[model samples]
Target chain A: MMWLFLVTDALLFAGFLGGYAFCRLASDKPWPDRTQVFDLTFITLMTFALITSSTTMASAVLAARNGRLQAARGFLLVTALIGLGFLGMQAVEWSHFIHAGARMDSNPWGVPGFSSYFFLITGFHGTHVLIGVVVLLLTTLRSLQRSNADELVEVVGLYWHFVDLVWVFVFGCYYLV
Target chain B: MSSQSGVSSYRTYWIGWLVLLILTVGMVFSGAKPVLVGGMLAKASIITLLYMHLMHERRRLVWTILLGIFLTSAVLVVLSVPDGMAM
Candidate 1:
């Protein structure tokens, strides 16, 4: 069921990205150069944070499988913290962009589509990360109780990895090429 | 799927994480270069296959996931071509 949800969610993102590509190519106005408007260093740090959270999530799953409940709880807590850190950075980035006059309807960069797509796509992905963090928190609590959380850890790990996977595409399309 | 014991070891996950980190740095340095897309694809595949344990899953399940991705990509590409051509 999670796989099915992921597959359909991926298709939804594909459609949004495809529409973004169309707008970018069809627009007469020059698209805003990503590097010019966004902080690459900050975004890179966010990427690392997210990937590290995935690592921590994997550790949590492994520890659970090994019946190390305390270790699993620790790892899950770390994962949640890292995810929260990533979202915090995103909030900062969004605020900076907004202060620079970028919005869904208008942008100082002259290409409205760029800001529109940027906010829409990144905002969508960020929301997923936020939800993942909340879910991780709950999973961590369950781990602390020493419940039979091995299966629960695996399911949550799948969702966490999916969030990270989506960010890979988001970073590629929005920040890189 | 096999039991939890069949899951890849922690070392495998660490290696995958390291590779993904390297790819993220590579993409940052590459800027908006076309090669960044390849790096992103590689990173995504590593996380899906190793970290997500899809590689150890049953072959039929793996194939289904791959097919879903492929079909989505094909549909999106086909849909985008006309708009791209119109540009």
Candidate 2:
């Protein structure tokens, strides 16, 4: 049942990834050098931050399952804060790219083929991160008040983890492709 | 079964995360082998396996992940509109 939807979603991303690959292959120009475009240190920290958020988010969910309200709230708060930091790092990364002239219209990769796809994929993932952050914040605050916190924690954990999943893809595609 | 299933999923998620964290560090130096391929495949596989139905224990996590894919596609379309149309 759940696997059904998961398959469909995988197919959808497959199509997108397929399209991106075809475009990269069809072009005469070489693909952008990832090591040059992305600051390794920033990306490394960014990945660490996001990975930590996933842990905090999951711990919060575990706490909720155990009926430990304060622990759950604390973990959720940490998750949200880490998520916020990821968003900030994303913003900073984007700005650095922009300042270096990595526009959606033109670039060292030629005609923004690389830039456009970079934005399309990473931007989409970043939006997910933003939404995940907000949801975690709200869920944590609600847990503090003792509402539908467990359900909310479950929901937000699903989302938090999903975003982490996307970053995994983005790391593969953007940096590797 | 339910408790085992739940704990198993938790354990699975954590293991996957640790692997991801390791791979993330591996990618930092732009490791020559292109870990992206293996890493992405590992990630997609983990979520699909562990979270097959663990969303709210309501339907399954897959549906929610799809909803996420749908929403993300909408966002991509929206972001691409101006450029897509101009092209």
Give the number of the best model, judged by DockQ. 1
- Candidate 2: residue A167 Cα off by (Å): 0.6
Tens digits of lDDT, candidate 2, B1-87: 023226423565577668767777665555655465666666665654454225334454545655766676566555554444454
For candidate 2, write residues A1-177 as lDDT tens digits. 323433464555545655565556556667777777888778878878887777777777777777788988898889888988998999998998888888876886574678877777778778778877777877776645666566667666766776776676666766755
Error at B34, model 2, angstroms: 7.0
**Which docking category, incorrect, acceptable, medium or high, applies to candidate 1?**
medium
The lDDT of model 1 is: 0.86
**lDDT of the candidates, in the order given:** 0.86, 0.67
Candidate number of the best lDDT: 1
**Per-residue alpha-carbon lDDT of model 1 for A31-108, expressed as tens digits?**
777778888999989999999999989988899888888888899999999999999999999999999998899989
lDDT of candidate 1 over B1-87, digit per residue (tens): 335435547787788788998889888887656778789889988888878888778789899999989888888878786777588
Regions of candidate 2 where Cα sits further than 4 Å from its true position? A1-15, A143-148, B1-5, B8-16, B27-35, B47-87
Give me the displacement of residue A76 in model 2, in angstroms. 0.8
